[model samples]
Target chain A: MTVIEKVSEHFRVMLGQKKEEHLGTITDLMIKRYALAIGDDNPLYSDREYARKRGYEDIIAPPNMVASIVDWSVGLKEEDLHEDGTPKTGGILPSNIQGIRVMGGGEMKKFINPIVAGTDVYVTTEVIDTHVKEGKKGPIAFLVIKNTFKDAKGKIYCISERTVIAR
Target chain B: MSNTQPLQVVYSEVEIGEELPILKKNTSPLQLFRYSAITWNTHRIHFDKEYALKEGYPNILVHSHLHGAFLTQLCTDWMGDRGELKSLEVNIKRFAIPGETLTCKGTVVEKKMVDGEGLVTIDLKEINEQAEVCAPGRAVIKLPLV
Candidate 1:
């Protein structure tokens, strides 16, 4: 199928196909590892005592760290797993345009609460919109998807809009 | 990565166009491993140099989250104890490979009040040694209204 044809087909199949999961609790290891990777020396992400002294109950994650909390075990819970987790049928990508290069075009987010270590992180993702534009070289697809992250109790921490571009 | 000056920021005392302290760090291959391990990102492009070469990159590419992390650090460093980051969104423009010195900078773009609380918006950027923009981001922060 042509790129346009494939994208149109995928769009219909993906409309409102929301996927969510209990990605498990946030751990100090996850927080500190992320902090260390970025070489951040902020105590709020490392020292529990320091965070408490600063008014947080536990070590709080850096705001942007929320994006890295996906369950990597390749063993997502049944409910959290989509009907087909394969790249061809899942997670926002349009199948049949396999040869195109994909890039993260941009992101927009709104944070409502802070996510602290030990709070179970949950994320729900779905397609909000999609647009096909003609680029300098050819047609490009901008897949706009929104992912909401919250603690297991349902208190939202943040909502992010990710724009994935395919050329 | 050892340490730096203490962070001290208050909303009312700050002004628009004020610049935050610059955050500079050299990314290493090992640091990339830690980032991938922590985030559970098994993408070969982040860690495998051969794969990167096949894709026409000079070296292993820095994870996009790493760029966002640096941008986030800049915002939090300015916020200090009296403020909190409300939101951050970044657009990755170029690939920052391991060992390049990346600098993060920000400027306060707007300040306002919501429900008796102070808020500030910042325009953020991360550039490589060559000074090319790698990731450009924006952040909204909530500050104490003392």
Candidate 2:
């Protein structure tokens, strides 16, 4: 069987399967770095007094920060990285598809609450849907993954539905 | 420093079909590197030009989430401190390389009062230097009613 077919076979069976992860605490430095990377000078992400004036308890993360972070782990060794520089595990897809090119198609995100600095964050990821479509090259697989980010008290911070394409 | 005290957007003043001020960004290689570092994204296509060429791209490509970030910034900047982004949706239609100019633009589409709060829906898009629509998106924001 072809590699795409093999990966699809595995993903088809993974539909509705969910994985939960503890993303650790949201830090002020992390929030500041993300805003800086985006070139966003919004004080809400950095100025605690400004955030408080805006009704938040403290500095808050950018709305897309949690969803955009690819890995929350400490570190990964170079030898363990795929040729493409992606991690061997913790990706949205099965490890068997490591060599295949993966790209983001799009995302739909809902912001439920502000993620304050010092809040412990957790994520629950689930494979909501999978399909194959004919592309210019060949058959491409589309995986729709849903990620729910919440705090320790079970208050949802954000829910994102993202489509990942494998070709 | 320019937006340290952003203008507050009042819901009563917002008009339907009004175009938002454009936010233009030219992704530098350094910016892309910082973005990858901060997000812990080690995807080679975003940084390694040789690998990106081997994968059929002209140069290192921009991160998809970066497009989302630009769109989100457009919304937040327009709404200012008094407004909150409730939801945002974006579809990346094309790949963009570093050093290309990407412009984020949006138009207010609908307005409503939900639970006495002003909610505005906007149609958002990012255009490349070639005038190609790289990413199209939408956002719902809650603005303070004054």
Candidate 3:
């Protein structure tokens, strides 16, 4: 099998494995900067007073903000690579195929409850699925990773599934 | 529980071909760090230059979620407080690294009345200073009739 094929095969076996990760706290400064980075000056995300006035007890983070907190390194550590230079047990596999790039595109379903500052979060990610497709250039790998964010109390905040293509 | 806005855009006034004003956003390390601090993302690729270079990046690359947030801001701002963002999907084609100016712009691609609501489909794009398309997106919004 080719390198890409080996990587794809490895990812196939990684499905259903719980990868534990700890995401730090939510802070007002972080929320405000993220809002600013996106050019959103919404009081709900920035001003604590505005948020309290809006009935939120405190400042709230935006939807899709969980992506900013997910531990991308949960699965494969660089040291885990074998001498063959292939990831052993992660969904992020190298596309042995050439000229195809995977872009991240997906809809995020957010919880009605907002994530407030001072809350510690933990994420447990798993390989949801993988499919091979024939693309314009060549065969592509469409990989999906589902990450669940929870507070220290194990309260679910949001679930984020990122889809990427590797050609 | 709806909030009214001063800059309300009526569905009737917006045309299918109208181009939304583009807002330029510059990505900085501080912004990325702050984002990381809040999100608790400690991916070396986002801040560690050597690690990123080992991964074959020229410098620390921006977080993928940040790209989505950038697009979300553009769409929400255009929709205004009165407008409701029913659905939004962002597909990232390239990375938005630090020290790069990403221009977020959009165009109304389709408009129709669905269930007494003005549903607008917009073609969203984020381009870097080098004119490369970093993140391309699409959004479905519900606008009130003025």
The predictions' CA RMSDs to the true structure, in order, are: 3.9, 1.6, 5.6
lDDT tens per residue, model 3, A1-167: 75456546755776666787876777777777767755567666776776676566788887667665443344445676432233433325543333223345554544434677667778888778887777676666667887778976788877766776665
Docking class of 2: medium
lDDT value, residue B132 of candidate 1: 100
Error of 3 at B28 (Å): 1.8
Output the worst ten-in-a-row residue range by lDDT, candidate 1 chain A.
A80-89
Can you write out model 1's per-residue Cα lDDT over B16-96, one digit (the tens) per residue? 999989999788889998887787655567787887788789999888778888888888877876677888899999999
User: Which CAPRI quality tier does the interface of model 1 achieve?
Assistant: medium
Give me the candidate number with maximum TM-score.
2
Q: What TM-score do all the candidates reach, one by one?
A: 0.89, 0.95, 0.71
Q: Which is superior by TM-score, 1 or 3?
A: 1
Please give the TM-score that candidate 1 achieves against the real structure: 0.89
TM-score: model 2 vs. ground truth: 0.95
Put down candidate 1 lDDT per residue, A1-167, tens digits, no spaces.
Answer: 67755765666566566888777777888888788777888888888888888788999887877765433456344454332222333445544355556667878878788878888878898888877788788787778878899876689988988777767
lDDT of 1 at A135: 79
**Per-residue lDDT of candidate 3, residues B19-89 (tens digit):** 88787877777777766655555456667677667766777777677777877777767776567666556
